[model samples]
Target: MLSHTRKNKILEILKRHKQISTQELEKQLSVSGATIRNDLTQLEEKGLIKRIHGGAVLPERESKNSFRSFHKRSEKNVEEKKAIGKVAKNYIENGQTIILDASSTVLYLLPYLTQYEKLTVITNGIYTALELKNEEDFNVILLGGIVRPKSGSVEGLIGSCMLNDISANLMITSAHGFNVKNGLTDFNFYEVELKKKMVEKSDRLIAVLDHTKIGHTSAAQFASSSEIDLLITDSQINDKDLKEIKDSGIEIIIGK
Candidate 1:
C-alpha cells in the first residue's frame, strides 16, 4: 500500500503489458482514481513513462539525451510565465482560428482563453488539446504525429499536412531561447520542424517567453525576428536586450 511500492507495481505492469488504463490501475492497485493519476504524473515527470489519454505508456528511449521533461520545465518561473500569458492573450480575439505549440509556457495562456467564443484551436500539444477538449465554446483540433513523452508534444511533422487545409489568424508559441541574430530557437529538433510549418500556416506569430530566454540561442531556429509580430516576456528583462528586440521591428510587451 506504500506509494513507492504501488508505483513499482505499476511499472511492473507497464513492463508486462506495455500499456494499461486508469481503471485497470485502480483495480490492480486497489487505490482511488486520484492516486493513480498522481502516480502517473510523477512517473511521467521522471521520464519513466508517458501519460496518454486515460492511461500511461513506457517512454521510448533513443539515448540518455532523449529524456527531457517539458512539465518540469513549465514549473519554473511560475509567476513570470503567468504574467506573460496575460499579456499574450490581449492580442487574441474571439471567433478566430489559432495555432498553439506544446511548449510549457504556452500552456499558461489556456486559463485566460475562456472569455473568447467560437474559437478554433489547432495544436500539436497532447496536454494542451486535452485541457481544451471539454470547452463547449471552442473547436479543438489535435494534430496527428509522433508523441514525445518527455516533451508532452506531438512532433515528426506528420501532423503538419493538416495545416495545408486550414490557415490560422495567429499562432502562440514559446522557445528555449532567443537572440537578435538567431531569433527564436528551440532545443527540440522535432518540435522546431513542426513549428516551422505552424509559422508558415499562421497569419501572425506571437512569442511567449520568460526573461531568461532573452538574448540566448538554442539548438535550432524556428522563427526569425522579422517573422514575429510580437514578443511578450516577463519584466525581468534588461533594457539593452529589450531595445534590440524592439528595434528589430517586433513589438514587445513586458509582463509585470
Candidate 2:
C-alpha cells in the first residue's frame, strides 16, 4: 500500500480519538515502528496533524482548512470524470444547442468538442468558456452574473435572465450530491436555483455524476430524482443504487 494511504488511516483514527500513541497505531495498523514514525513526521509537515510525543493528532484549527478551491477539486476523480464525459459526448449532435453545466466533468468535454461544428454551447462556467475560447466552429454563450470563484460559475438575476431566452436541446449537468431523498443538491442557494432553471429550459436533462456523488446529499435541494432524463456514472457504482435510479425511469449509462 502507498504511504499516503497509511497516513490517511492514521489521520482518521486521530480524528476519532483526538490523540493516539505510536504503539497503539502500530498495533491497530499492523505497521512497523519505522513506518509509523515516518508517517507521523510527514503528516506534521503537511499541517494535517501535529506530533505529540510518539503519535500525531489532527490539526487544532481544522475548520479553517475545510474549504477548497474548484481548481484543486478538478484534478481529483479525473478518470471517472473523463469516462463520464466520453459517454455524455455520445448524446451530443451536430448543430445542437447544448447547455453544459458548471462541472469539472462537463469541462472535460471541451477537448472532445472540437470535432463538432455549428453547435451552440451555453454555460455559466468561467473555466468552460476559457477552455473552448479558441475553438472556431462552436458558438459559445457565457451567461453573465455574480461570479463565485469557489464554484467557478455565475449566479444571481443576470444568470437567470440569460437562461430565460435560450432553450437547449440537451442540458448536461452535474451535482454536489445525488440521494433518493434530495435527488440533486448543491451547497449554494443561488447555484441550486440556477440549476433548476437550466433543467426547466431544456428539452432533455442529462446528469453526469461520479461514483462518489451517489447516495450523498448537500444542504440545498434543486430537483428530485424524477426530473432527470439520464444519469451517466462510473462502473464502480453499486448495482442496487443503479437499479434504484434506473427503476425511476431515468436511463443509467455506466462507463468503465
Candidate 3:
C-alpha cells in the first residue's frame, strides 16, 4: 500500500486497539518492522500517537480544535459527502430560498442543484458561491465578512449581520463534530456565530453530517439536537449513538 494509505490503516487499527506492537503491525500490514517503526515515528511527530518500546498508543486525548482545513477534509470522505449531498438536494424545491453553509460537504450539492429551475442560494462559502456563478437559473448571494483563508468561509460580525437580515426556507449545514450533548459543534468561533445566525433566519435547519462526525464534540456548539429540524448522515453511523440522537427527537435521514 502507499505510505499515506498505510498510515491511515495504522490509525484505524490504533483507534480500535488503543495500542499496537510493531511486530503486530508488520504482520497485519504485510510490511517490514522498519516500515512500521517509520510509520510510528511519523504518527508520533503528528501528535496522533505516543511511541513506546515496541508499539504506539493513541494520544492521551485529542484537542477540541483538532480540525483539518477545507482542502484536507474534502479528500477524507468524498463518497459519503456525495451521498449526503444528493439526499440533501431532495429537500430543496424550485423557486425556494435556501442557505448553504461553508462546508466542504455542502459543496457536493452543486451538481444536484441543477434539478432546480429557479432558486435563490445564500451562502458564506466563497467556493460554494463561485461554484454557482455559472448557473443562470440560480440567484446566488455571497455573504460579506472576514474570509477565513483556511476554509474559504466568510464569517465575523459582517456576515452575521447579513444573515440576520434574511430568512430562508431551509438551511443546509455541516459541523466539525456532533454528539447528543454538544449537538452541532465546530472549531472556528466566527463560523460558529455565523451558523447560529443561519439557524435563526431559517424556517428549517438540516445538519448534513458524515459518520465520522457522529459522537464527536468540537470547540464550539452552534446548535443543540433539539434546535435542529433534521439530520442527514451516512448509513455507517453507530447504532447506539444513532439511537440516542433519534431518542432526542431530531429527525434523521440516512443517506446510502
For residues 1-110, write the lDDT of model 1, one tens digit per residue: 87756776787688667789999999999999999999888777655678999998866651222344777777889999999999988988999999999988889999
Q: Candidate 2: which stretches are off by over 4 Å?
A: 1-66
- For 124-208, candidate 2 gives per-residue lDDT tens digits of 8998988988878888998888897765888767888888888899999988789776798765556677888888889998889
Please list all clashing residue pairs in model 1, or write none if there are none. none
TM-score of each model, paired residue for residue: 0.73, 0.73, 0.74
Instruction: Compare the candidates by TM-score and give the number of the best one.
Output: 3
* Model 1 global lDDT (CA atoms, 0 to 1): 0.85
Q: Rate the local accuracy (lDDT) of all candidates.
A: 0.85, 0.80, 0.84
Minimal lDDT window, size 10, model 2: 61-70
What lDDT is reached at residue 133 by model 3?
Answer: 98
Q: How do the residues 1-256 of candidate 3 rate in per-residue lDDT, one tens digit apiece?
A: 8775677678767766878899999999999999999988877765667899899886666422243466876887899999999899999999999999989899997899998988999999999999999999899999998886767889878888877678899999999889988889875556777888889899999999999989877656789888888899998899998999889988999999
Lowest-sum lDDT 10-residue window in model 1: 59-68
**What value does the lDDT take at residue 112 in candidate 3?**
95
Cα TM-score of candidate 2: 0.73
Give the clashing pairs for model 3. none
Candidate 3 displacement at residue 182 in angstroms: 1.5
